[model samples]
Every structure is written in structure tokens, then in C-alpha cells.
Target chain A: MTLVTVDDVRGAATRIASDVIRTPLLPCARLSDELGLRVLIKPESLQNTGSFKVRGALNTLLTWKENGTLPEGVVGFSAGNHAAAVAFAGQRLGVKAIIAMPHDAVESKVINVRRYGGEIVPTDDLLGTTEELASRYGYPPLLPFNLPEVIAGQGTVGLEIAEDAPEAAAVIVPVGGGGLISGIGAAVTALAPSMRVIGVEPEISNALSLAMTHGEVRELPRAERTIADGLAAPRAGNHTLENALAYVDEMAVVSENAIGEAWADLADSAKLIVEPAAAVGLAALRTGAVSLPAGCTVVLVVSGGNADLVKLAQARMG
Target chain B: MTLVTVDDVRGAATRIASDVIRTPLLPCARLSDELGLRVLIKPESLQNTGSFKVRGALNTLLTWKENGTLPEGVVGFSAGNHAAAVAFAGQRLGVKAIIAMPHDAVESKVINVRRYGGEIVPTDDLLGTTEELASRYGYPPLLPFNLPEVIAGQGTVGLEIAEDAPEAAAVIVPVGGGGLISGIGAAVTALAPSMRVIGVEPEISNALSLAMTHGEVRELPRAERTIADGLAAPRAGNHTLENALAYVDEMAVVSENAIGEAWADLADSAKLIVEPAAAVGLAALRTGAVSLPAGCTVVLVVSGGNADLVKLAQARMG
Candidate 1:
């Protein structure tokens, strides 16, 4: 397997520059002061689809178009940000999108995908089966993970961090199907060999962490219920698992309550509206899951902001 | 008073370069398609203080320091974002900040100010009187309006729009004490005189519109009930009133329900969490209180994101 290189990541950056927002790298003074280390945040929550999913989705679709491999249309199955990202990517790239969503996906996200001109097919039941939904789509399926181009595309985020903050001692990212972490880890390990890469996951869905421990892609029988719905993947992707195992320095899991508290903490302090998944890195740090070496600068990737308003309201009320 | 020149506003752009986020002027294709006119949004709701208030506040305080007139410390009376702005501004400038807030201010906002390293003093009553609170702390209040430097500072937002979208035919701004409008109007009028400068206000607390008709700042016997607490100014300031009369092309008022709907509309469509005051401009457009000129390009200045979570929850539930 040819691991994606820094050059490919840089190409992805150039290709997606116009469409995606090169979100800010803000200095978190309070967090820095508290941790006794310099802390910088990649505000990917501000991205077009409210997540970094847009980067990989767009890059993959754009690459397919440029290479003459894109089909008549694209199809994907996702309950949240990836669906929206695929829809947005299709719209911007002039490709039609057919998205399969779980019956119980948040109405806001469903509406957003439709608003962006994607056709949605909702499953009657969401009992952990998406293969049937993909098969029913008739055309082709676009798995968010298990895509080589998607992994290479997402590595650009880490490529950016390495370029923007070369002195960064570590980079932290929330793991879902391990696509984001795999891509980021590849870039960091390639560009800055000394910079450590850390993966954060919800305690309920520590699939990648468990996989890393077991030396292969492992499926958890039960999906972890987490407010950070974006990061609660039940299984790890083969390609991503290989990448994570090779490059990622450490992995940590955070509880749902800690994720909620981190979301509130950012909203209250940084005046940012980020989803629970995006806050998991900070949550892990706050819970002392990962300790920062003194004066070492760390970059936390805030994954997205396509939050469920009802869920947020409930958290705030509680 | 020497009116703010294009040059001064340009200087402000340079001065706040490293400090402020150069927020995107996002195009609203759907909103534009609905209106039969082009619509662009300047989303200051994503600003550091969750409002454009910080632009003016920081600019005013920085300009004061540059001119050698700033005191050892600064203070302000605000419901929330402004308090947080003064806190952020003070922290950046290395000064202590004391914010005077009404007892009934949103807990979310009160917590934000203190989280940003500002001291908060909750008042004994929820009434409009704040002079005693300001004096008790021995802090010269940072007025949102009635301050030339602040108005000039806020005008930088308009300057950005004028620079970014020279073809924009009209600019919409939400009015409170009118500092935002004052700044926007001055900058837009000077930079893009052909562009109309429209001001929007919540119908219940439209002090600027009423003051325009009456030719003076008049206090309402009872404050109007509205979800847009940020725009619930009891009375207009003399300077704000004068600037509105001279620079604002037109003023329109929207109902409380309209404001709430606008907030929800943006959230549902744009996946953005905006405060009610920021929605007031869009509310006016939706309610037919403001009309776009034929085939014109309109810029709606989204001023803040300091929404009270409780109010948002109620709105969502309804």
C-alpha cells in the first residue's frame, strides 16, 4: 500500500482552497494558561458543512472528476456531517448526489442536505444496518471511510497544521471511522517526524483504540451512545486502521458528560458553537486523558458544528 | 466632529489585523433567489465577542491607548456580548475590566464575561438605570454609542463590506443604541455613497426609528418585550440619533415574532447559531418592512451571536 504523502496533501490543499474555508488557528489563552502549554485550535467547526468532512469529500470527488473516474452520480450513506459534506461536495463540483440517511437522523441535517440539492433516501429502521440501504440505492455507494482518496484528502488538515505550527509537539483529532485521524496522522508523521499524533474518541465508541490494541480492525458489538454522534463509530475501517496503527502516537476516550461539558466550556469561553465530537479532544485534555509536556504546543482539531439543536437545548437545560 | 473618513476606516482594518477575524462575506443564494435580488451576509455573529461590538469596543480602546488617553482600567455596562467584548478588549490590552450587568442578564452571558477574565457585578434591579453601578466601580464606562471612536471603529465592518462587495446596492444593519448603524452608515455612505444604508430594529424597542420621527432621544415608559435583548435599548444616545438622522438611508422595525423566526430560519438553513438581533435585519426583509431595490445586491450585517440558551430553547420548542 502506498501511504499518502505530504505532496498529495499539499495538492489537496490547493485543490480545495477556493471552496473550503481555511479555518483559523486560534490561540486558546485560557486553555494554554491552564495546561501550562501553548494551545492552538483548528476551527474546522467553521467549515462549509460545519465539519472537516467537507475537505475529504470535496477532495475525493474533485480528484475523481479530474482523473475521469467519477460516475454519472455519487451515492453515500451517513447519518450526519458526511452526508451533508457529500451533498455540498456534489453541488459545488456539479455532480449529482444520492444520500442514504438513517430514519432518525436529525431533521436539521436532513434538511441541510436537501437544501444543498442532494437526493435523500431514508431507511425505515436504523438497527446498525447500512449495507441494505446502500444496496437499495441501485447505482454506486460512496463510503466515507474505506476510500483511498478520502484518506489522502483528509491528510491535508494535518499538512496544514504542520506548516502553520511546525513547532507543535502534538496534534489531537477526534476519531470516527478513523478517516480523519488516519489522514492527519499520516501528514504529521511524514512532515514533522517529531510531532506526535493523538486520536480522541468517545468512551462509548472506542473502536479504533480497541483495534489498535488488538492489532486489527475490530467491531464493537454495541454502538456507544454519545452526544458527539459524529465520533461514535462502531467499527474501524481497514485502511484507516492500518494508517492509525502505523502513525498515531496515542489514543484517548472521553465520556458523554465530559464531551457535553467541553462543548459548554468552549461556547462559554471561546464564544464558539462546536458539536460534541469537535470538543472531544479538549474534553480528553480537560479530563487528563493526555498530559502535555511543559511548554509543548498542541493543536486540537475542532471537527465540525452541524449540531442537533434539540440535543444542544437539552444539554443546556440540564 | 470630523466624520470618519475612508482612510481612518482603512487604518482600523490594519490596526485590528492580527486581533480580529476577517469573517467571510457569505453569499445567500436561496435568500437571494427568494427575494429576486442578490443577498450577501457579513456574519459578524461569528466575531470574537459573538458580535461586531468587539470591533468598535476594541478599536475605541486601542485608538485611545494609541492617542495616549486610555486610563489604567476600563469598565462597561452590557447585557452580555459587550461585557464580554470589554473583557476581551481589556485582556488583550492588559487592563482590568469590571462589567455592570442587570441581575436578570442571561446566565450564559454573565458566565462568558467572567470566563474571559473580567469581573462582573450584578445589579440589584433589572431596571434601566446603570449610572450608579458605573460610578460605584470607579470605572469610566465604555459606551456602545455616544462615543465617536466607537462609532468609527464599528464603521470598519461597513468598510469591509464596501471593499469586499463594491457592487452591493444596499447594506442592512440592526440598530440598538445605533453605534453599529452609526459606524456602518458612515463607512458605507463614504465608501459606497450609491449604496443605500438601511437600519433595522425590533418594533418593541425601536428607539432609533421613533427618535428619528420625534427628532430626539426619548425614553419609553415601558421596555417592549422581545427575544432580541441585545437590541432592546431603552433610549437612543444623542450621538447615535444624530448619526442615524444624517447617515441612515432608511429605518424599519420588525416584530418580536419576526426576530425569532429569522433566528430559526438561519439556523435551519445556514446551520448557524445567530442571536436575535443579528436576525432582525433578515426579519425586516422577510416581514416586508424593508424592500430591496430592483436587481440590487444587498448586504446584511449579522451583528452578534449572544443568544440566551433559554430563549433559544423556548423558540425551538414552540
Candidate 2:
């Protein structure tokens, strides 16, 4: 099997350079001063489609376009960002796009998906069950979580960290179906083996952690709650599981309230509107669930900022 | 007084290169597709202090330190960002800082100021009345509005813009005390005189607009009521006014609701948490307050992201 490597990430960086926004690596003096660790943030929140999902989605779409697999149209089922990503990528490639989103998806996300020229189909199926909609779209689904090219594309983030802060001891990534962590885990291990790669998950939806413990893919009960809808994966992907088992060092879980609190802290204190999944790394660090090595340079990959507006308002009100 | 030029910005870029984050310039394809104009954003929201205030503050404090102004310490009065900036600047310069904020200042800003080693002096003096507190602090007050060096320091933004997007047809900036606009205006005009320099102000605290029409600084009574507290300058500083008058091509005012909506749009669409002041530029463009030349490139300088968490929550909720 041809697997993703550092060279693929470098190629992705080159291919996506003009299209993707190389979101900055910011020094978190406030977080650092508080944690006594050198903290830096790779803010994927500023990426196109308001999330890092765009990186993998765009990369996959572009690769398909290059490989002639991009047919008359493309489709996807996503909570928000991934749908937006497919729409954006399709729009960029001048291909038709149909995005199936849960009926309960945020109004803002719905608007953005439409804004990017995607045909939005509302699903009556319960929230968090997206695979069925993907299969029904009449086109190959754009899987943000499970593809090799997508994972290789997302791994460019780790490539950036290694280039920018070589001394970083650990890179913490928020995991969902484990796409982000799997990509980053492999990249960091290959490029900077001394750097530890930790995956953070919302406790209610710690599918990756469960998989790690079980040493196999475990399907958790549905209806798990998390403010980080992006990270609320019900099960781990086989590809992502293999990557995690091979390269990822550890998995840590943070609570629902903790996720909300971290989200609020990111917005209020850090001046970022990160989704709950993106905040997990900070949540893990803040809550002392992970005792970082002393004086270690730590990098937290803030996954995305396309949070539900109403939920954000609710979180703020609470 | 010695003023900062594009050369100074180049020098600052090198000096702060090792310290400050090189913020990304994002092309808004969605906005670009909607409008005939090509829109680019300098996301200073990702700055070290989560605001562009750090640029000027860093330059000024460092200049003072190099010139031997480290005798006692530094002082400032602000509702949010400037306080943190001064504190950050002082800390970097290895000096003591006393930041006086109003009683109603946002909690996150207060915490950030404190976290940056600033000694906060809470004052009952209502918004726009910080002189007394500054006098009490003994340390010379670093007024956000009045300082020439601050404006000159902020001029560095324009330098970056000219270097990064030299073909830009217009540069829009959020205006508060006019320091940012003043500096940015000067740099933009000097670097690319053909580019239209525009200033955006919250309708509530449009001191510079009133000053422009009247040919003198005029304090507006309603400046205290806006959600964009950062841009709520009661009076325009003479130095800032001079620069704005000389360099700015147009000034537009955005409503409070527009600011809130812009904030929400940024969070939802752009995945950034820009404060009301920073949102003003986008608000003006979104609301069609700022007319663009057809097919021209427009650059919006998002000045900061140090939003008040509680206020953000309220905005999100309401």
C-alpha cells in the first residue's frame, strides 16, 4: 500500500500554496505564561471554509481532478465545515456540488454552504450520522476523515510546525474520526521523531481513545454530546486507526463543559472562535489531564472556528 | 519628532521577526466572488497580543528602551487591547507597567492585562475619562490616541501591505482614536499614493468624522454607547487628525448592529473573532458603505481580536 509520507505533505504544501491560506503560527504568551510551557498555536481556524477540513477536502478534490475521478459533480455529508469545504473546492474547480447536512446544522453553516454554491440537502436523520447522506449524494463522497491524500494533505500542518518551531517537544491535535491527528501524527514522527504527538478528544465522543484502548475500531453508542460537533465522530476510520496505532503517542479526553469553557476562553482570552474540537488540546492542557514535560515547547493545532452561532451564543450566555 | 517610514517598518519586521508572528494575508474568495472587487485581509487578529496594537506598542516601547526611558516604568489607560499591549511591551522591555482600565472594562481584557504583568488600576471614571487615573499612576501615560510614535509605529501595517499586495487599489482600516488610521493612512499614501486610503468608524464614536467635517476635534456625547468600545474615542488626537486628514481618502461610519453582525460573520464565515473596531472595515464593505472601484483589489486591515468574552457571548446570544 502506498502510504502518506513527509514528501507528500511537502507536495501538498506546494500544490495548495496558492489556494490554501498558510495560517500563521502564533505565539501564545498568555497560555505559555499560564502553563509555564512554551505554547504556539497553528490557527487552522483562519483557513478557507473556516476550518482545516478544507485542507484535506481541497487536497482530495484537487487530486481527484488531476486523476480524472472528479466527474460531472462532487458531493459530501458533513456537520458544517466539510460541507463548506466541498462546496468551496467544487466552486474553485467549477464542478457542481451537493452538500447533505443534518437538518439541525447551524443556520450560519447552512448559509455558508449555500454561499459557496453548494446545493444543500437537509437530512431528517439524527445529527452525527453523515455517512448515509454521503453515499446517497449520487457522486463519490468527499470524506474529510478517511482518505490517504486527505491525511497526507492535513499532515502539512505538522510540516509547518517542524519548520517553524523545530524545538517543539509535543504537538497536541484534536481528534475526531482521527483524520487530523493521524495526518499530523505521522508527519511529526517522520520529520521530528523526538516530538510527541497527542490526540485530544471530547470525553463524550472520545471514539479515537476508545479505539486506541480496544486496539481496534469500536463503534460507540450514538447521540454523544459535545460542543465540538466537528470532533464528535461515532467511530474511527480504519485508515485513521492504523495511522494512530502506528504513529500517535497518546489520547486524552476532556469533558463537555470543559470543551465549552475552553471554547469561551479561546474567544474571550485568546481572541479566537475555535470549535470545541479545536479547543480540546488547550482544554487538556488547562485541565491538567496531560502533564506536559517541563519547559517543553508545545504546539496546539486549533482545528477550526466554524462553530454554530446559536450554540456560541448559548455558550456565552451560560 | 522622528517619524517611522517604510524603512522603519522593514527594520521592525527584522527586529520583531524573531518575536512577532508573521500574520497571514487571506484572500476572501467568497467576498471576492460576491463583489467585483478582489478582497484581501491582513488577519492581525492573529497577532502576538491578539491585536495590531502590539505592533505600535512594541515599536514604541522598544524605541524608548533603546533610548533609555526605563527609569520608572510605563503607564496607560484603555478599555482593553491597549492595556494589554502596553503591558506586553513593558514586559518585553523589562519595565514595570501600570494599566488603568474603567470599572466596566471587559473581564478577559482585564485578565490578559494582568497576565501580561500589568498592574491594573480599576477606576470608576466612566469611559472616555482616563486622564485622572493616568495622572495618579505617576508613570507617564501612553495614550492610545495622542502619541505620534504610536501612529508612526502603526504605519508599519501599510508598509507590509505595500510589500505584500502592491497592486491593491484601496486600503480600508477601522478607526477608533484615529491612531491606526492615521499611521496606516500615512504609510499607504507614502508607499502607494494611487491606492485609496479609507477609514471606518463605529457610528457611536465617530470623533474623527466629526472632526473632519468641522475642521477641529469635537467630542461626541453618544460615543459611550457602541459595542465597539475599542473605537470609542471621545476626541481625535491632533497628531492622528493631521495624518488622517492628509492621507485618508474617505471615512465611513458603521452601526453597532453592523459591528455585531460583522463580528458574527467573521466568527461564522471567516472563523475569526475580530472585535467591533476591527469589524468596522468589513462592516462598511458588507453594508456597501465603502464603494469599490470595479475589478480593483481591496485590502481590509483587521486590527485586533482581543474581544471581551462576556460581551462576545452576549453578542452571540442576542
Candidate 3:
């Protein structure tokens, strides 16, 4: 199977360089001191659309434009981050973005997509709705994960982690559909082969872990939702699963309570406003869901920061 | 008429090198794009104990310890940030920190000081209570700002900013007791003399601006308080005033409304959980209180992030 190459990621980096922010890695000194491990945070929450989704989205569109196959519009389905990303990127490239979103999507997510001039189609069947819309309008389907271009785009994050924290013993990444980790895995495994690529998922949303164990895609019920809405991908795409199986070294699942606690801790201690999905990697380490040896340095991909301020406040109060 | 010298700042940098965070400058792409001016953020909010005050507190204590004049106990007065800093720093040095804080101090700030093993003396008169406690207990007073040692320590931040973003057109800092900006002004004037040093204060708590205008210290009534509690210094101490007069180039005062709006915007746009005091520099730029030429780069010191989460949630809701 053809997988996302590090060269593809290098190409994507050049393509989306102007479209995306070169997010800095903030050292979590407080957490590092407590854990006796160097904790580096690549805070993509401070990214253009407040998530790493922008990299994949922008790369997918920009690649098409560069290859002279740019479509008039794109259709995709996501719980949140990917939707906003496609909307923002499509608008930037003068391509329309139509997102088939869940009825219970986060208000901010919906707002962000609209703010970027993306049209939303409310749907109970996210993937089906997106496919139908794409087919009907002859628009290209912008897969949130699983596609080679998307995976290659997301791999840019891995290239950055490898470049920024070459001494990192492991890079812990949040796995939704496995697009981010697969791309990162490919890059890190090739460039910083010494560093392990660890994937983390919410305990309930363990599609990536289940897929790796069964050596196949395993879909969860749509009703089984997680507070980390951005990480609600029920199954990994074939491309992403293949890349993960080939490149990811380990997988860990964190509890909902731990995710909540870590989310609050990250804000209070690191002064970072991160969403629940973004906090899961830190949660994995904090709760020993993904334990590393003491004194080992680990890089955590803080995927996004589209957090609800009200919820953050309530968490702090608790 | 001696002020915080560049050499003094250099010494403080060496003395407290390990004690504080070497805060990185985050390039604000969104704000820069919106205003057509390059904006960089020096987020000291992620410092140890979540404020730049730790630099001064640690430096003051470390300087004495280095000189072999270390005392058994230290006393100080503050609304919040300094109290926590001294508490954390004193505990590190095996010195007892007794902080006389206002009765209406933020609960989180109070909790942090106690968590760091400091004794709190509740008082109506912050300085008077602290002085009385220090004199009665025969302990050396740890002034929050204005002393040569403390100014030198805070000047370390200026040194970092100058070194990190040497091309900055101006470094906008929040002025409370004038220790932070005065130290920074001294360093920036000496090192990056081409770069401007702009001090920002809440309109209601404009002690630094007032002192600079009147050519002497003028104390405001303690009852008049702004939401930027960390910047509620009634007046500057003599040393800070002298330093400001010698080194500071410009001053800006922001409205209470602008402060609140900027506090929320920093979280929403930048994903930085900063306090109201830390927001005033951005507030000044946003409210057109400190406009600069288009395309010129400016650095804003995000001084602290020890904000009340519940209040933040409430603000978001509003």
C-alpha cells in the first residue's frame, strides 16, 4: 500500500507555509518539573483556525490548485475542527466548502465555519450526507482523515516535532481518525527514528487502538459521543490505519475524568486554553495511561484550543 | 539617582536563570493581519507561579542569599501576584514568607500563596500591615517593586525581550508599581535603544503615568480600583519613579471596557489565558490608545495568567 511519504509532507509544508502558522513548541516547565520529564507542547490551538486541521485542509486544497485540478467546491464531514479548517482553507483558495455537520455540533465550531463562509448541511448521517452533497454537486470530497493528501499535510506537524524536539524520547499525539498520528508517525519514524510515536484516544472513542489490534477498521456507534468532539471519529480511514500500523509505536486510551482534569490543569499551570481533544495527550501521561520513564523527554501535540470558556470556568471552579 | 543598570539586569539573569521561565515570543498572526502591524507576545504569564513577579521575588531572595545576608523570614504586601511569587520563592530558599494581602484579594491568588507555604495576614492597609508585621517580627521587608534588587530581577524580562525580538518597534508593558516597565525600560533603553518602551496602565489605576507627568510620586486613593487588580499600585516607590523618568519613552492608559474586551479577545484569538492586567497592553493597541505605523513590529508583555477561571467563564458568557 502506498502511504504518505515524508517528501509529501515536505512538499505540503512548502505549499501551506504561507497559509498556516509555524506554531512554536512551548515547554511545559511546571508539568516537566512535577513529572521529572521534559514536556514540550506544540500548541496548534494558537494556529490560524485554532487547530492543526488547517494544515491538512489547506494542503489538500492548495495541492489541487497547484496540480490544476482545483474543484469549484469541497464537501466534508467533521464534528468540528476539520469542518472549520476546510471552510477557512477553501475560502482562502476561493473554493467553496460545504460541511455536513452533526445536529449537536459545538456552537463555536458552527460559528467558526460560518465565519469562514462555509455552508453547513445539518445531517444525522455525516459521511453519507457529505458524499451525497459531493456527488450531487460534482464537488470533491474533502476527507477529514484517511486520504493520502490529508495525511501528508498532517505529517507536517511530525516534521516540526522532529525538527523542534529531536531529543524527544516519544511524541504523544491525540488520535481521532488517525490522520494526524499517521502522518506524524511516517515523518518521525523516518526523520527522528529514535523517537517513538504514541497515539492516544478517549477511552470510549478507541477506534484507532481497536483498528490496530484487529488489523482492520472498527467502527463505533454514532450515539457514543465524547466530550472531545473533535476526536469523535468512529473509525480510521484505510490510508490512515495503514500508516498507523506501519509507523505508530504504541497506543493509549485516557478516561473522561482524566481528560477533564488535565484540560483544567493545562490552563491553570501552563496558561494554555486548549479544547478537550487537545488535552487528551497530556491526560494520557498524567493518569499513567501512557507512562514514560522518568527523565525522558516527551513532545505532546496540543491539537487545538477551540474550548468553551464557560466550561473552562466551571472546570476551574470544580 | 542610581537606577536598575543593564549590568544589574545581566547579573539578575545569571542569578535567577533556573528560577524563572525563559518565556518565548509568540508572533500574533491574527492581530498582526487585522491591524497591519506585526505583534509579538512575551508571555511571562507562563512563568513559575504564573507571573513575572517571580523574577523579582526570586531575585530579591537569591541576591540576599548569595551575599550571605540571607534572613530567616521575608514579609511583603500585594493585591495578589507578588504575594504568591514571594511565597513560592521564599519556600524554595527555606525562608518563611509572610504576605499581608487585602481582604478582597482574588481567591485563587490567596489559595496559590498558601499552597506555596506562605502565611497570609489579612489586612485593610496592605503596605502598613506588611511593614508592621516586618518590624514587629524583626524580619527584612521584601518589597514587591522599586528596590534595586527587585528592579534588576524584573529587568531580566526586558533583556530577554530585547534579545528575542531586537527589531521590535516598541515593547508595551503593564505598569503597576513601575518595577516591571522601569526595569524593562532601563534594559531596552541601554540595549535596544532604537526600540520604544511604552508603559500601559488602567485609566483608573494610572499611577505610573501620573508619576511620570507630575515629576514625583502621587498616591491615589486605595478605594479606586480597576479590574486589572495586578496593576492597582496606588503609587510608585522612589526607585521605580526615578528609573521610569530616566528610561521610559512613552505611556498609555486603557479604559476598563477595553481591558475586559481585550482580556476575552486574547483568550479567543490567541488562546492565551491571561489576566486583565496582562490584557491592557493589547487593550491599548486594540482601542487605538497606542497606535503604531503599519507593518512595524511591536512586542506586548503578557505579564501574568493567574486569572480567575470562573470570572473568565462569566466574561465569555457576557
Candidate 4:
């Protein structure tokens, strides 16, 4: 398996520069005081489509257009943010997008995909339905995370962090299908080799953590449902796993309760509204699942903010 | 009243440059599309102390230090943000801060004040209690919005906006005691005279709106308590009113429901977590209380993000 390179990540950054926000690196003063480590928040939650998925989606679609292979339409499968991003990119480029979402995908995410004008098909078999649609309708498939192009796209986050928070000793990212952290791992490990890259997942959705332990990607039995819905990918992308093996330094898993507590704390103290999946890195750090030394500056990538208000309210109630 | 000038704002910007985040101006793709106008977001909610009050607080104390008149301690009355900011500024500058906060101030905000090392005195009469403390202890009063230094500091936001979103035709700011808008009015009006300055207040805390109608600073009987706790000031400072009359182009009052709706929409679409006071600017625009021409570019200042999660949950349940 060919791992993605920093140059490819740089290219994606140039390609998608105009489309995505150079989301800020905010100083987490409260957390810094509490943890005795300087914590900087790299909030990709503020990115276009409210997630880092926009970077990859835009990069892939923009690459296709650049190659003059832009299809009339595309079909993709995602739990949420990626599908919405694909839809948004399709709309931006005047291409049709049909997305297959999990039958039980969060309502806000489904709404987000539809808001971008992506035709949504609910299915229990997310990948199978998307594949069938692509084959039947003659639309090109934009597989979410498995592609090198997507990996390269997401690596831009690392490039930005390297530029914006160079003082950071480590970069922690949320891992779902490992698309985000894979790209971040590839970029950061190549460019800032001294800075360790850590991936965080909910204990229930610890695919990347388990893969790191076993030295290979294995499809595990579906884990119990997690509040961190975005990290529930039971298996990592094949390309992502390869990239992870090459670049990622460590992985950690935090409990559902920790994730929930982190989510609320982030909003209350940090004034950051982030989705449950995006809160896992903070959860890991705050819960002692991934402890760093005092004075160690860490950059926590808040990967998305497409949070459901209802879920946010429920968290408050608890 | 001696109104603040753009140069004063510039000096404040330089003075507090290292102490605060130069918060980014975010592109609101969804809001821009829905409004058929370019809507950029200036999220001071991401500022130090999670509000723009830090700029004013930092500037006020910094100026005192620069002039060799730095006091032994400072007394201030605020709903929350300003008090917390004063506490933060005092901690940074090695001065004591005693804050008079409303008994009904949001719990999170109260926590913020305490966290910043400010000694809090809960009071029904915020200003009177603060004044009494200042007189008794010889701790100079750091009034929230009336001071030229504080207004000048907040005006730095306008300086950044003028530089960052030069295309904007209008700037919508949330008004409490008019300190923020007064400062912004001073900067934007001086730096970009063609741009209209609009102030938005909740109907329950329409001090500036009523002041504009009356052409003077007038204390209205206490209105109904607003969900926008930060914008619940019943009167504007005399200096702030004078600046508003001179530099502010218009004032609008929005219903509490509109503020709540706008807060949720900001979280949902723009992925911005803002307090209800901050949401009123968007609420005014969304509710047609401050309508702009189609294709007009407008900048909305999300003034702070010290939101109560319980309130957020309640908004979601609605």
C-alpha cells in the first residue's frame, strides 16, 4: 500500500484553499490551567460544512475537475459529515450527488446532507447500496475515506497545524474511519516528525486503537452504539490503515461518559460547540486515557461541529 | 461626551495585541445564501474570556499601567462578561478585582468570574454596589462601557472588521450598555464611513433602541428579564449614548423568540456557539428588524459565547 505524502497534502491544500476555512487555533486557557499543559484548539469544526470532511471532498472533486474527468454525478456513502460535504462539493461544482446514509444516521446530519441538495437514500447496507447506485446509474463513486486522494485532502489539516501551532509537542485527532487522522498522521509525521500524532476514539468505536494494537486492520463485530456516532466505523479504510501504520504514533479510547462530559465542558468553559465525535480527543486527554506531561503543548483538532441541538440539550439535562 | 476615535482603537489594538486572539472572520455560506447577501461572522465569542469584554478590560488596565496610575484594585459591575474580563485583566496585570454581579447572573458566567480570580459580590443594584465598594476601598471603579479606554478597546473589533471584511456594507452589533457598539461605531464610522452601523437589542433590553428614539440616555423602568442575560442592561452610559447618537446609524429591537431562534440557527448552520445576547444581531437581521438590500454584504458580530448549557438544551427542546 502506497502511503500519502506531504507533497500530496500540500497540493490538496493549494487546491482546496479557497473552499475551506483556515479555522483558527484558539487558546484553551481554562483547560491549559487545569491540565498544566498548554492546549491549543485547532477547530476544524468551524470549517465549511461544519466538518473537516469538506477538505477531502473538495480536494477529490476539485482534482477530478482539474483532470477533466469530472463526472455528471457522483454516489457516495457516509454516516453523515462526509456525505454532506460530498453533496456540498457537488453543488459547488454543478455536479449531481446522491448519498446513501445509514438508516439510523443522526437526524441533524441527514438534514445537513439534504440541505446541500444531495439526494439521500436511507439504507441498512450503506456501502452496498452506494455501490449498487454507482454501478446502476453510471455515476462515478466517491468512496469516503479509502481513496488516496481523500487521504491527501485531509492531510491539509496537519499542514495547517504545523504552520499555525508549531509549538505543539503533539497533535490529537478524532478517528472515525480514520480518514481525518490518517491524513493528519501522514502530513504531520512527514513534516513535523518530532511532534507525535495521536488518534482518539470512543471505547465503543475503537477500531483504530485496536488496529494499532494488532498491527493490521480487522473488521470487528459492530460495537455497542456510542454517543460519538462519527467514530463508529467498525473498520478503517484500507488506505487509511496503511497510512496509519506508516505515520500514526499512538491511539487511545475514552469512555462514553468521558466523551459526554468533554462535550459539555467544551461548550461551558471553552465556548466551543462540537459534535460528540469531535469531542473524543478532549475526552481522551481529560479522562487520562492519553495523558501528556506538564508544559507539553498539545493541539487538539476539534474535527467537526455539525452537532444535533437535541443531543446537546440531552447532554445538558444529564 | 468625548467620543472614541479610530486612532484610539488602533492604539488599543496594539496594546492588547498579544493578550487576545485576533479572532477570524468566518464566511457564513448558508446565511449568505439564504439572505442573498454576503454574511460574514465576527465571533468574539471565541475571544479571551469568551467575550469581547476582554479587549476593553485589558485596554482599561493596560492604559492605567502605561500612565503609572494602575490602582491597587479595581471594582466593576457587569452582567458577566465584563466582570470576568476585569477579573482576567487584573490577574494578568497583577491587580485585584472585585466584581459586583447581578444575583441572577448566569451560573456559568459566575463560575467564569470566580475562575478568573475575581472576588464576586452578588447584588440587586449592580452599579450602586460597585460604586459603594469603590468609594469605601479606594479601588478605582472600572465601569463596564462608559470609559473612553474601554470603548476604544472594543472599537478594535471594528478596526479588524474594516481590515478583514472590507466589502461589508453594514455591521450589526449586539448592544447592552452600548459599550461594544459605541466602540465599534467609533472605529467603523471613522475608518469606513460608507458602512452603516446597526445596533440590535432584545425587546426586553432595548435601552439603546429607546435611547435612539428619545435622542438621549434615559433609564427605563426594568423590563422583563431577557434570555439574553448579557444584553439586559436597562440603561446606557451617558458617554455611550452620545457616541451612539453620533456614530450609530440605526437601532433595532428583536423579540426574545427571534433571539432564541437565531441562536439555534447559528449553532445549526453556521456552527457558531453564541450566547443569546450575541444572537440578537442575527435575530434582528433574520426577523427583518434591520433589513438590508439584496446583495448587500453585512458583518454580524457574535459578541460572546458564555451560554448556559441548560438554556441551550431548552432552546433545543423548543
Candidate that would win on DockQ: 3
Which has the better TM-score: candidate 1, or candidate 4? 4
Q: Candidate 2, overall lDDT?
A: 0.78
lDDT of 2 by residue, A218-314 (tens): 9888775677878767788778888888888888888888888877666655667777778888889989887787778999999887676556656
lDDT of each: 0.79, 0.78, 0.89, 0.87
Candidate 1 residue lDDT tens string, B203-282: 88888888889998898668645678788777888888888888999999988888888887765444456788888888
Task: State in Å the error of residue A32, model 4.
Answer: 1.6
Which number leads on lDDT? 3
Task: Return the TM-scores of chain A for each candidate in numbered order.
Answer: 0.93, 0.93, 0.97, 0.97
Report clashes for each candidate as comma-separated counts. Answer: 0, 0, 0, 0
Per-residue lDDT over B1-318 for candidate 3, one digit per residue giving the tens place of the 0 to 100 score: 787799999999999998777888888766787778888989888788889999998999999998999999999999889999999899889999999999999988998898789999999898789889989998999998979989999999999999988899999999999999988988999999999999999999988778888989999766668999999998988899999999998899999989998898877778898888999998999888998888999998999888888887777666
Indicate the worst ten consecutive residues by lDDT in candidate 2 chain A: A125-134
Off by over 4 Å in 3: none
Question: Residue A308 deviation, candidate 1, in Å?
Answer: 1.8
TM-score of 3: 0.96
Question: All candidates' TM-scores?
Answer: 0.86, 0.88, 0.96, 0.95
Candidate 1 vs candidate 3, DockQ winner: 3
Given the true complex, what DockQ would model 2 score? 0.51
Model 1 chain B worst lDDT run, 10 consecutive residues: B124-133
- Model 3 interface DockQ: 0.69
